[model samples]
Target: IAHGEIFLTTGGRSMDRRQIWSAMKRLCQKAGVAPSKVFPHNLRHLFATAYYRVYHDIVKLADMLGHSSIETTRIYLIESGAEHQRQLERLGLVS
Candidate 1:
């Protein structure tokens, strides 16, 4: 926010968890998305899942996420069963 400090979350402010949650809540309201459905971790997980899916490389995903171990990266690689089911159908494996 100042000359040297950096912020990972959006808006470029050094926000606490509550502030970040409140901002995301307001944004969800404006986007007509249920506030309960979105959060910073959700976005992070989505990014991890999509990145791993595209690259098909756990080590690379780990490096990108700054995880020290592949086991931690596995946590991000997991997705909702519904999403996996959709992918299965897309592959014509469920038909």
Candidate 2:
């Protein structure tokens, strides 16, 4: 299978959101992490946020997230509040 191809085959059917969430919860429990802190949707958010942080390229991010508009990606993925404040501080712009 390729990178994006689905691997599991249950009667040649695709896994739904509940199955994915349950798997994530089980994995998180095994790893000694709170399941609430790392749900499946949270993983998607983390991916978008991390990619944006590393590249700062909204166009690429929008494409990766399958978003039709960069504006939607920006609203969902842009770091603000405490995270934004910390980033500014790290860059010596908050002194």
Candidate 3:
């Protein structure tokens, strides 16, 4: 891997955006997963959500994501309705 390169081709050259997306799509297909739901940008959302769950620090996450405003990071942390319902269920207040 070269400096600042997240992924590289077999020839040791840096992988461009299209190549990364294509690679991800092919891997998803091989794994029997829906390629439509998996992509490089979606992985950023997944990572931000999981990291926020563990740390609960939006400011740091914003910095890590290179966002000048924490509000932008908040968009990445939005929980799905299913997850929100699960949390409400765990509260035992609606039983």
Q: Cα-based RMSD of the predictions, in order?
A: 4.1, 2.8, 2.0
Error of 2 at 77 (Å): 2.2
Give residue 3's error in model 2 in angstroms. Answer: 6.5
TM-score of every prediction relative to native = 0.67, 0.74, 0.87
Over 19-93, each residue of candidate 2 has an lDDT whose tens digit, in order, gives 888888899999999877877778778888888889989898898778999899988676669997887789995
Question: Best candidate per lDDT, number?
Answer: 3
Better of 1 and 2 by lDDT: 1
Order the candidates by lDDT, highest first.
3, 1, 2
Give the whole-model CA lDDT for all candidates, comma-separated.
0.81, 0.80, 0.92
By summed lDDT, the worst window of 10 consecutive residues in model 2 runs over 1-10
Judging by lDDT, tell me the better candidate of 1 and 3. 3
Write the residue-wise lDDT of candidate 3 on 1-90 in tens digits. Answer: 333777889998899889999999999999999988988999889889999999999999999898999999999988889999999999
Please list the residue runs of candidate 3 whose C-alpha ends up more than 4 Å from where it truly belongs after superposition: 1-3
Look at candidate 3 and give me any clashing residue pairs: none
* Model 2: colliding residue pairs: none
Question: In candidate 3, where is summed lDDT lowest over 10 consecutive residues?
Answer: 1-10
Off by over 4 Å in 2: 1-13, 93-95
TM-score for candidate 1, residues paired by index: 0.67
Candidate 1 C-alpha error for residue 1, in Å: 14
